[model samples]
Target chain A: MSPLQTTWHHIRRSPFQSLIATTAMFLSFFFISTFIIINSGLSTVLKYFETKPEITLFLKDGLDTATVENLQKDLSSYQGIKEITFISKEKALTIYKEQNKNNPLLTEMVTASILPASFEITVSEPEVLEKIYQNYSTKTNVIDEIIYQKDIITSLLNWTNATRQVGFAIILIIASISFLTMITIIGMKITNRKDEIKISRLLGASSFYVKKPFLLEGIIYGLFGSIFGFLFSFLLALIFQKSINSFFQPITFIDLNVNFYLILLFAEIITGTLLGFIASWIGAKRYIKF
Target chain B: MKIVFDQVDKKFGIVYALKDISFEIDQGEFVFLIGNSGAGKSTLLKLILNQLKPTSGKILLGDIDLSNGNKDDVNNTRRKIGVVFQDYQLISDKTIEENIALILDIVNYPKEKIQSRIDKVIKEVNLGTRRFLFPSQLAGGELQRASLARALAIEPEVILADEPTGNLDPENSWNLVKLLKDINKENNTTIIMTTHNNEIVESMGKRVIKINDGEIVKDYNISKKS
Candidate 1:
């Protein structure tokens, strides 16, 4: 029989052993894919929030248009201002009404006079948003209340950074476990077929020929393992898409694109193949000598 | 292929297995390596097969220095040499035909010619009727013939048998030796076999190399087979 057929024969003969190794690979891959899903979703939300206006200052209702223009000019002179725009009473009222149109109770009494005009500022650096707000809100007579999103942006960014680290850490731990487990499982496989390997060597088979079946078996383990893992995570995402969406702001939901799936599949297969190859090589090294 | 050993020394840990051992077997010669247990008979076979390298000397297979050969070169050398083991070492799961086919395929023999080649070896070893049987279903004598068929299928220049008749009865052992002698004479193939069977050693009367305590104390030619 051909070497590939021999590989199949070995895998076919040992169902439970193959299952255990593949399952080890499957579980690890599934965990990594799940991490990727949550991480991507959170990253998308954080990116959305990151682009919104960083700081908003509500001026006193009686402030004249010229006073608002002067507040804008003062904000412009600050070091990190990207853009500063003064929202007039009419625009602020229109926006407030638009935001509360479904809640007539909240909007029925609101009018231009009641709604304070504000300065909407976009900063080049997020850190400067707090600095600009602290300096202008406390000292200016024109400012009635400050509605800066500094805290929200800071915490969101922190959460993003922290989750990214956590995802990386988890992947690291999972990869280590997969590598060790692969070595062990492949080692056992080598031991099981030790006699065949010796016979092959005695027949003047090349070293690669002797090791090929087990290596292919390793690759098969990794390949099927990762494929199953990817499917598991995808199914979980589909089942819990709404629940996952609830964790983010109501404005945006997770978009599962074909491109993302394709990329994930490509990445996972490469990882599985590499792990299988390396682990199989190491394991076969010990027993192929016979 | 002619086999030559020049001042070979093999040590496992601190103990020597074969020390200052040197010998030569001309092409197509049938030689028996006879020694008691721990007499370095197996070590001598391992050295000839290049499975274990000599610590301080050289083994040459037809002018190819095996001690300095690379891994790939070693495989190339082994391809020209066939080895048979005491336990018959046939793959238990495979049929007798498949066991021979395994080696033929490994050496990348021509696809259309593999069947013919296997048939020829089976006929030579008188295993044609048992080709479809697995090793476990065969008797001790049949298994040895199947193993011989596998070794001959490769059409190797040298056949190294490590106690080929170790488990056989006198009739079976004599049959196995006669087969080796015929193959050696007909194909002009070099045969180096290690054995402790004094009856066959004295009766067959071919060339004999006797070893004791990691050294060859006797190398002689007896009267031809009667």
Candidate 2:
């Protein structure tokens, strides 16, 4: 018989045994892809946070309009300066008023003239923000202290990196466990077929001839497992997309990229094939002599 | 062509199963091996099939030394030998037709030829009515007959029946023996039947080789007229 035909026959002979191993492998891939999506989402959020202007220098009470213009020009030419935007006190007051409009008490406390003139400073990289602050702090004309949300950014980076590490570790552990489980199941099934295999060999069957059916069964398992895994991951991503959009709507964090889907599909296929091959190989190796 | 064992010795660890056994079966002869349980009848057959390797001496199948035969030679040897056992050994899940076709399938017989071959073998074995039945669905004699039909389907040079009638009733046993004799006469297929049935040995009136404690104690040929 052809290898494919033999494999189909073996699979039909034991449907439940094949299904259990494939389903376990499918879940492993699904969990792994879900972890990948979450990590990708967090990294995108961190990248968005990095792009916002970090330091804002508020000017003192009576600097002239020409002095402010000269300050903006000098800051623009400074090293480590990616961007320099002069936010006039009036424009800053308008933005703040719009933001706090719902809080009537806060709205009454802020006015165009009362707000300080500021130069919004964005550094090339946040790691060198301390040096940028020190350089700007030494300048006499730059009146008020630098305003930067360092603690919030640092904590976000830490949490995201930690999540990435922990998520990957957990995925690895689960994959390993599921792989072993599938192997055990396949091994048991192979053991049950010991009599049939013996009869085949004694009847003049080759090793390749005996193993063809089993390898075919493994391939079938892989195809079905990967399909189920992909469906599961896709459904999960769809469910999570709404929550992600609601949470990070201000930042462009929810990326529904087609490339990511393709990568996830590839991961599922790889997982399915490896799981099936390893399980069948180990099982067959134990029972099939030569 | 004839098969011969030349001073063959088989040992498992320290115990000898068949020691210094020498015998020959001429082409187209129906022979019976008679002994108590564990008298090395099965082991002798196994040596012929290369299922068990003899520790010393040689087994010749028409001058090919099977004692030192490697896997390729062993497999080639099995192609010409059809074996049936006391237990049916038919795959329980498959139909009687599938069981008969299995050996042919393994040997890569043409797909078009398999159906006709199965039909012919089942009809020859008088199992045409139950060709579609599974092993579990058949009685002991019918299962044994199905197994024999499967063995015969390959059209082998040698038919090895190991206690072929062990599980059958007297009537079934007689029918099976008659069937084997008929197949032997029609095809000139060399039949080596191992059995404890002395009545069968005498009734066949052919050749009988008796084994006691792994040694062949008696060899006799009976004329057909008697």
**Residue lDDT tens for model 2, B13-93:** 998888889989988999998889999999998888788889998899876788777777777778778888788788877
Candidate 1 runs further than 4 Å off: A58-80, A86-117, A125-128, A131-145, A246-253, A286-290, B7-21, B35-39, B55-57, B128-133, B196-205, B211-218, B224-226
* lDDT digits (tens) for residues A250-274 of candidate 2: 5545577889888778867876886
- Model 1 residue B70 CA deviation (Å) reads 3.5
Candidate 1: C-alpha RMSD to true structure equals 3.8
The estimated TM-scores of all candidates read: 0.85, 0.85
Report every candidate's CA lDDT.
0.85, 0.81
Global lDDT of model 1: 0.85
Q: Write the per-residue lDDT of candidate 1 for residues A159-203, one digit (tens) a residue.
A: 888988988888889778887887887788788878888888867
Q: After superposition, how far is residue B97 of candidate 1 from its true place, in Å?
A: 3.5
Candidate 1 interface RMSD after superposing interface residues? 1.0
Highest lDDT, which number? Answer: 1
Provide the TM-score of chain B versus the true chain B for each model in turn: 0.96, 0.96
Tell how far residue A110 is off in model 2, in angstroms.
Answer: 13
